[model samples]
Target: MRLIHLKLAARNVRRQPHRTIALGGAVAFSALVMTLISGFVNGMDSAIQDNVTLYSGGHVLVSGYTVSWSGRLQSRFADEAVANIVQSAYPEIRTASPISQTRATVVFGSREVQLSLRGVDWGKDELYHSSLILSKGDWKSLAAPRTMLMSAQTAARFGLSTGDAVLVRLSTASGQQNVTDYTVAAIYDDGAAGGMSTAFVAFSDLTADLNMKEHEQQAIAIFLKNSTSAENAAQTITKALSEKGYTVSRGAAPTSGALSASSESFVSSVVGSGAAGTAATGTTTGTAAGSSGAGASRRAAAGTVTYYVSTVQELAGEISSALGSIRWIGYAVFALMLIVSATGISNSYRMVLLERTKEIGMLRCIGYKKKDVFSSFIAEGILLAGGAALVGVILGLPVGFGIGLVPFNPHGDFGTALVQGHLKFVPSIGQLALILVFVTIVAVAAVFLPAKKAADVVPVEALRKTA
Candidate 1:
């Protein structure tokens, strides 16, 4: 009986070619809009996320607060405690590198610029190589403390390529200034580090230059077996360190401009409910392997605070917020399209039903019941919506495919162009399914009342009026 009704419904719909085209077109357009917008937003989120995770830092970063000497601000961290905590408690760590983090000024002849400087344990700098696009020189030379790496933009700005000497001046931990010359060993095209405004050196070189001990560091970039394990792993590692008689500092959520935050920055982003609310920019390219556990070990010292921990997701809070805002924008566009399509479908279906009143009444007078007529019209709507959604999805897939094919390389302008909202488009199957299901429900529901009204017409009255 259902199959017969469906056949009759399809035949009846075929009698109104113009109405079918108009109504189906409305649904198709709505589906198309939702598909593309959602695709673009999700894609951007992925790109920005990969930009940060694969290059800017690791899945989790451990650090302490920034201190100031005169007007120079610097961020500091101690590595031994963090390494010991991870090695002893969490076997999940794939690779970890200690950093000597600071902000400094670079001079090329008379040219000077402020930069975020990091001295990395080259043996375990997993993220650096993953995000690296070295246009000149080799990474091996950076094994020396006097050797440094710069961005292509910085190299161009200073008119210095690989092997060029650039003067660096830094504010020491003791409220004094220190100056040194670093030979540029390589220049990268990595955009996630904000181009040339961020640079790297050998960890020993930074410690020696700043007159610091080897057991200390500014931060530690830790790659884990799973990025999702960051919060739990952070807590477990914290507990292990505490058991060793180390006191951990607390922190608030990071300001948009800050790096791996201090102890006061921990509550909202690192170890608690704050992470529950975050809109995770999905993971990609997984954590890379590195030489795990190579740094100096710290004694189980009492009365000392180990570093604070923040995930790459927290480090990318601002970008995630920006990506979320774009999603809202996409939602707005999709809502607008839905409204327009619903109004068009409703009004057009009403007009078509008005023309079909006599046909409906005649069918009612025969063996067909009102519910039968209603079901037939509903089946027609289902088929129409299904057909329209298929067309829209077909149209949308190519667009998504084309956008995905475009590579992400935000080098020359430090991804400024991308930051301005030009981002990659990822073809997410889940998003596509969501759009199709939503559009289908709306399209089929829009004509329900109109079909019921047409089916309810009095058979005698409709025939008499037509006669």
Candidate 2:
């Protein structure tokens, strides 16, 4: 009986092609808009995560800072010790490398620029090397001492090329001024880190220049097999480190600007000039890792090591907030569109009742029950909405792909949301299914009152009305 009603409803839907098309168009438009907006937000979130994982830090970052008895703070950790603990304790860690980071002024002739300089162990940094999209030169050159890799924008600004020597001046670990000459090894696209100059130098060269001892590094960037496991992995790793007699602190990730400013201040304070016992940018929280233990009180002993653990979500900083805002805006737009579609569907169904009055009377005269009449109308609504939404999803995927292909400025304000200078659209299958169901329900609900009213009509009264 239900199948019979659906068949009749399907025929009725086909009987008036123009009305069906016009009515279905609203639902279709809503679905298409929702698909594109959701895809864009998902893509932006993914791009930020990938960018931070590749360039700045990893899925998880572990850094340590120490306070001297004289009230000075130093952000440094024993690389070998921390690496061993990280790899052994967490099976999720796919790759971990200790990186030395500092802010330095690079001088090419008379022009000088302050940029974030990081020391990378390229030999073991397979993920970084593989993910880097180079515009010019080769990574092999980094094997040589005092060689650096610069972003294409920075390289262009400095008119630098492979083998061109540049001067980098930085403060050593002991607060002494030191200068080193480096040759440009490679230039990269600078996708996520665009507008900010970030350069990479050999670990050996940077450590030696910074006067760091053997196996000492500022932070260890850790990658996992699954990126989403970052927060859980951070907690697990923090617990392990704390149990291993290391003072651990849970810290929020820093934005690029905050990181740079903090690094500069940290370097300047190495000579005992900055605030006394101030925490570095990497360590924001004072609480012990994975516990509610006292934050600063945990650093009671002089020269006590404090390890800070953060995840990519934390490290994403302002970009994360921006992505969230875009997501909520997308939802608001989707809700508004749904409301508009619902209003249209309700009004159209009311008109449908008027046009189908004679048909409804004829069916009632043929012994059709009121429930059968109501079910038929509801089924028609479902078919129209579901079919329209399906078409919308099908059309939206290609439209999204086309939008992604349109090139935009990587240096723009929303550049961080782009992937490799292009907008990325990631449509989730689950999200699509939910959208279809939601649209079908709203559309069916809109027809509910009209369907019920049509079912309640007296057969003689309905038959009296002209078609």
Candidate 3:
């Protein structure tokens, strides 16, 4: 606590420039690595959370479930009445966006691709304006009837661009095969996972194409004013809907079919059914208006219903697991760096202890307490490690920024984690604090044994041995 102890510690550190520099340098390097790595990982995790939650999946997803032989999820078409009831009941919901989709074979010259024809209320969908990155063209261009947006990559692969026409082959909900040429309105890069190619159209156009009623939607996506409250909102909404006689069913959740479905498989359904060719086909049961099937009886069929409520975190479980794995890797890296830095620090203190043994004995003989010597040594270690860590952090900022300057588009499985599939370092105050605490503990621990050894020596014996 005295100025004398401070002066003595400074003298001891200056007495061995090389040893101090070696220990300090190790701490500096470790701190630099820690700062950059943690920042990078945080950046990547944030991107994925933002993009997936905002675009592909809402913070909470609401839809129906059906048990079908197909492993893939099938949409449970709900009437507009359901959406109205839910919204009126829960004003916590900002919007319950209606969306429907169906399989279609799109052809442009020799390049033929099977994709899902998605109908969205683009005018009301804020996600596109907020996070949708346009690779080319604009949403306004897709406004005309029979016009849709495609992935920038898909557009490139087909040698198609805005204003070009692509042929769509689909079977309407009316049980009719229809082939129509659609204009390419715009192209966007959905940099999230799955490399999904979605061409969106107005909700009205899709209903006309699918022969679906105006008040029906395959799924309803609920967006809340505060996204953090997604889980609670989903729970409340699900409970209210369940009370309305729409019981939840056990069924597989649907996949965004375009990216997952193969052209060959989807085309088989579209190609062979003129009688039931690859064209659109529709079906109706019961007797015709003026005819009967031999002996027909009128009996009402009982209806079955099921609902599935999920949060964005639950839907993106794989991504959460991956981020966890990345954190574990960071822990390993941090531990390894600390271990390596500690060894260097311990060795440096060991050398200082050996050289200062006689001096420590002399201090004890001059009425200085062993605790004083210990404090001095500990203080010296702090200056060496703490000062170095500060310097390292300062130096690391530019390096981290330099790395961020490069384009980081994480795609595929890892890529899906990105909000817009880009990476940038955003340092964590807590993580940095942990790093600093680590530096101090390791530094002080490294000095302990050596300082103890020096302080315990006998002064007269030490001088006799030196003489």
Candidate 1 ranges beyond 4 A from true positions: 12-14, 54-56, 65-79, 191-197, 242-245, 249-306, 404-422
Every candidate's lDDT: 0.66, 0.78, 0.67
Tens-digit lDDT string for candidate 3 (249-280):
22225442221224222322222212221011
The C-alpha stretches of model 2 lying farther than 4 A from their native spots are 191-196, 253-299, 465-467
Q: Please write out the lDDT profile of model 2 over residues 1-467, one tens digit for every residue.
A: 48998899899889889988987888898899999988988998988888777656578889876544433456665536667888888897878887888889999987889998988888778666767777788777678888898988888888888888999999875567999889898888786453345899888889999898877787888988888999899999988876765556777522222223344333333313322332322222222222354421232223444568988888888889988888888888888988888888888889889988998999999999899999999999999999999999889999999999998888888777778789889999999998899999988888899999989988998888763
Count of backbone clashes, every candidate in sequence: 10, 1, 27
TM-score of each: 0.80, 0.88, 0.79
> Where in model 3 is the C-alpha error above 4 Å?
1-7, 54-57, 66-73, 79-94, 102-104, 115-117, 170-180, 189-196, 207-211, 225-227, 243-302, 409-413, 417-421
Which candidate leads the pack in TM-score? 2
- The better-scoring model by TM-score among 1 and 2 is 2
| lDDT of the structure predicted as candidate 1 | 0.66
Residues 1-467 of candidate 1 have per-residue lDDT tens digits of: 39987898788678888878887887787777778777777666555555555544567666643322221223454435457666668788888777665678999999988987778788877767765777788887787669998877777888988878888998765446899889999887645433324788888888777766677566667787776687777777667755654434433223312222242233222323212111111111111122357432212111122346666666667767877887888888888887787788778778878788788878989877888888887787777877787798789878766765665555553263243224555657887787778876876788799878877888999888877
The TM-score of candidate 1 is 0.80
**Candidate 3 versus the native: TM-score?**
0.79
By descending lDDT, how would the candidates be arranged? 2, 3, 1
In model 1, the clashing pairs are: 77-217, 77-218, 250-263, 250-264, 251-263, 251-264, 251-265, 251-266, 252-264, 252-265
